[model samples]
Target: MHLDPRLSFLSGPSVMAQLMRDKDWSDSAVGPPQEWPQALRSVVNLLLGSAFPMFVAWGPQLAQLYNDAYLEIMGAKHPGGLGRPLLENWAEIRQDVGPLAEQAMQGHSRYLENLPLRMRRGRGEGEEDTWFTFSYSPVQDESGAVAGMFCACIETTRTVLAERDLRARSEWLQTLFDQAPGFAAVLRGPEHVFAQVNEAYRNLVGGRDLIGRSVADALPEVVNQGFVGWLDAVYRTGEPFIGRAVPAVISRSTGEPPYEAFIDFMYQPLRDAAGRVDGIFVQGHDVTEQHRSREALRQADRQKDEFLATLAHELRNPLAPIRSATYLLRSPAAPAEARNRATEILARQVDHMARLLDDLMDISRITQRRLVLKRERLTVAAAVESALEAGRPLLEAKRHRLQTNVVDPDACLDADPLRLTQVLSNLLNNASKYTDPGGRIAVDARQSGDSIVFTVSDTGIGLSESAIRTMFTMFAQEQTALERSEGGLGIGLALAKGLVELHGGRISASSEGPGLGSRFVVELPAAPAPVAATAASPAAASAAARPRTVLLADDNSDAAEALAELLRLEGHVVHTAAHGLQAAEMAVALRPDVIVLDIGMPGLNGYEVAQRIRAQAWGAKPLLVAATGWGQEGDRQKATAAGFDRHLTKPFDPQRLVDLVGES
Candidate 1:
């Protein structure tokens, strides 16, 4: 192509410049370069020579001209857009760029950074967002009047989008920090000013607004407790501090006294880019409840050790006297009076030991919820009389004066008569043991409104406040002198409390002070509308005695032989078996009228023996009795299920056993 001399400046290695040189500009808004003014020519030459993105919008029609660097921004509009007006090529962005171009033509320079534009730039895609940093300067004519606007620009889409994504990620991380499980906070500077705190931190301190406040001012109660000093240490040394179950007195509410709390926490120093410590990050859990639970477990373990020691001492105390009594009885030269005295001592100590065992068993039953109450309607006076009978020996031995004031002897109660008697007896026995010899003890029972109240007041060694607080706890005992060590196994009152509560009643004790006497009060709800009672039929007369064969089975030889002798004295022929297999064999051979079997036996258990016995044709003729130490309700049910007629615990009354055989 032969280029015209007037358009020689358009001769270059640039694609846009080469395109301009070959075009005919006769119909364009700006005429050919041959007739173009000096200012437009100079600006166009400058636009084509630059390596940076640059463009020119000239004349009233805004004819467009741009360097090769600006072609990328034009996208699909390139080549065809070389000679078009600025609005024609970029009409989608007219609202944004129109004013800038107009200002430039009026002799003012206009600059914009990251100006957003939505225009078609791809070949087949729809209009999309774009960004640019560009400036527009006026190109003056030879007469000094503005004729066009020159724009220098660069696309900033990638940079702007990157910054936007970074901000979004930062917000997501902030949300996660706020929702952390434990309390968290950030403190800034040497003063430890609160910079940020999570939701848990807010709740830990009772929702106080803590931002911008120093640690010492916000938590004044903790200032003297060494927490502030710890924070200062962490910030100064840039070292972390960890604490477990650390104690602090914190005021969780306005105008409230401070309460103690234990926390597991850490203070970590935060560092800046230069590695200099700038702040401290606090994170922790309120572990007060867990700490208390652990301490309670430790205390309970200590109490258990003490209780075991006391039990051993109490059990051994009676052994020496019993052994002495047995030795005295074995001597033939002992006189009648001496023999009777030894026998009496034996009886007394055996009774004392039996009572202790009973209390221990009762405590176990109550704890296991297996103690079923046999509830019945009875009079308060009847219960009081039974209790006094059981407690008379101790009261007489102590020479204590007993005064009974049953103002309402007829006050009725819907309770287990046996358990009620036990409760009253425990209190009476406790009084007799603690009271000095010849002290006065009073028992008062009265009906008060819808309840029955029983008060047992005694002139005794009164209770201390510490003892009063824990006296009803199991295995809890008063700190008494060695002389008062005979105060029983501390389990009596604990058992009493459990029994009373089972009947929907409450028991409490009060004392004026040590040596001023103590009073125990028991209040039970009165029987709701009393149920009418049917007249009791006279007891059935004892059946005429019949000489029937009885089979007795027990692993304990003495127990089996003794029971066999008792049955013989009742005019029944009795045979003894030392184990379950022998008892089963004997039952088959004798075809006895009654069989007393121990539930726990060698060779075969009582349940299996009973099952085998019932399988025989002759088994239905004999009455089966289960006697063993297992006495829970479930045990009775099991015995019955195994074809036994009755269940009896060990140490059952001998008279009852004889009566059972006679009835058979």
Candidate 2:
């Protein structure tokens, strides 16, 4: 460690100073230190002794001279870079730093913050990106003329790279926030200024501008709806608020009417580092459809329960009378007159039960799209007469005065006669049931244009406004109707509506109000009278005394035997089969002239037995009859398809069966 006396001013324990002391500067542009001027030497002395990173470029070459602190900035270019020209050592950055150095040499000074440059600073040969904060000033010669440049610099590469990464992360987080499925937003401060909002949030508010606006100002509708108050509460209390199926009324566009919506949402309080509430985070889903569906399900469930109860009550009513009638018929001590009366009672009760079952089946068929109409061209008078017959008993029981007016008795309809009759009877029955004793009922059927209109009006306990709205819905009954014994199943009007619609017709009901009476109007398209249309004479009843061979099949042994006895009583030879298989065998063996089969019989159902029997030659001559509880028109068609000549529902009058057998 021998120090050179000529460069003794290169002081301190600084690494650069020691390296300068041993350097051969004779060939340098600035020349040897011994020949250097006092101004250049004095500046170099101060630069090498300073703690701050400083550099000196003296003479026309602008040869480099730097202190120990500047060595770290030089990286691998240090030691050998001590006396070289500034551009020569920092050649990678010449285009950027060279101009600053030249300006300093001309007696100008410049300061730069974070000057970016590409330089060879690492041990590797490849250039690296770098930044620095530095100031360049003039260094003068002994003659007071600027001869070189001086720089004070600090590397800022780390700080710049750190800031760049932070900005990229912020952008990524914002992207995630915007893409959320539910509406999301951030509100800042007690005033609840909207700081950020996602696409969904913007759409929820009808695409209105919202960022930077307070909730009260952006959505004024929400202020009165208590939403703004909820937000304020969340912010003030620093507690989260979660609401489910909460209703809100919002106008989707400016000047549009407001609409209601149910939403599931949460407002979560945001806190600063000190734990003081600073904002709120909002997230939610629009659940209006879900809310409506849930409410509808609840209502349907309630209606189903009520319907089951009413159905049980209605079924029991007929069963009680039928059971009493059966007991009376079984008693040997009963008088012949009493037994005859009991038989009539049994017929009436059975008919009532059959009607109830028919209504239930019709509804099921309508819902399933399986109801088949037996459409026919008939005079309007005929349908009206049949309907009047069906409803007469109820009208008489209630002591209601009935009046009928068919303006055009010849008005024709291409409709299902039975279904049309059913519809009219239902309206008449409903009218009679709801009317007070001795009330007035009227029926008016007329042809206005190409359509026939039938109106049935009643002076009764009429419908209320609310009742009218739900009158045609399944199982819907007015409170007044429910309180009365004649409420029925609440499906009479519904069934009528279905039947009317099936015939390409519409039915409507209107009322002045409760106790003010009601009117029902059914309009159907009129048809031109058929060319072959003729009034048919009613057939007189014939005594069931013609003898014939008959086979009766039923899974219920009692039913089969009872029907067989009834046929035998009509002076016909009758045999019984307890099941379908036996009936098929018996028909082939005996070749009976008539066969009555219960459709629901097991061991080969009635349909299969008929199909089997018809496959044989002798079976063609026998009349096949279907006797079962399946009374839908579809069932009738099915029985016919199975080769049955006639289809009759079970519990049909014994006399009808006897006549069917005797005729065969």
RMSD vs true structure, all candidates: 4.9, 5.7
lDDT tens digits, residue span 315-384, model 2? 8988887888889999999999989998999788778777887788889899787888888888889889
Which candidate's TM-score is highest? 1
lDDT of 1: 0.86
After superposing candidate 1 on the true structure, give the runs of residues whose Cα lies further than 4 Å from its correct spot. Answer: 1-72, 79-87, 91-120, 123-156, 388-411, 428-473, 478-494, 504-525, 528-539, 544-551, 562-575, 585-594, 612-623, 653-664
Q: How close is candidate 1 to the true structure, as a TM-score?
A: 0.80
Angstrom error at residue 660, model 2 = 7.0
Q: Where is model 1 poorest over a 10-residue stretch in terms of lDDT?
A: 535-544
Rate residue 148 of model 1 by lDDT.
87
* Candidate 1: residue 285 Cα off by (Å): 2.3
- Which predicted model would earn the best lDDT? 2
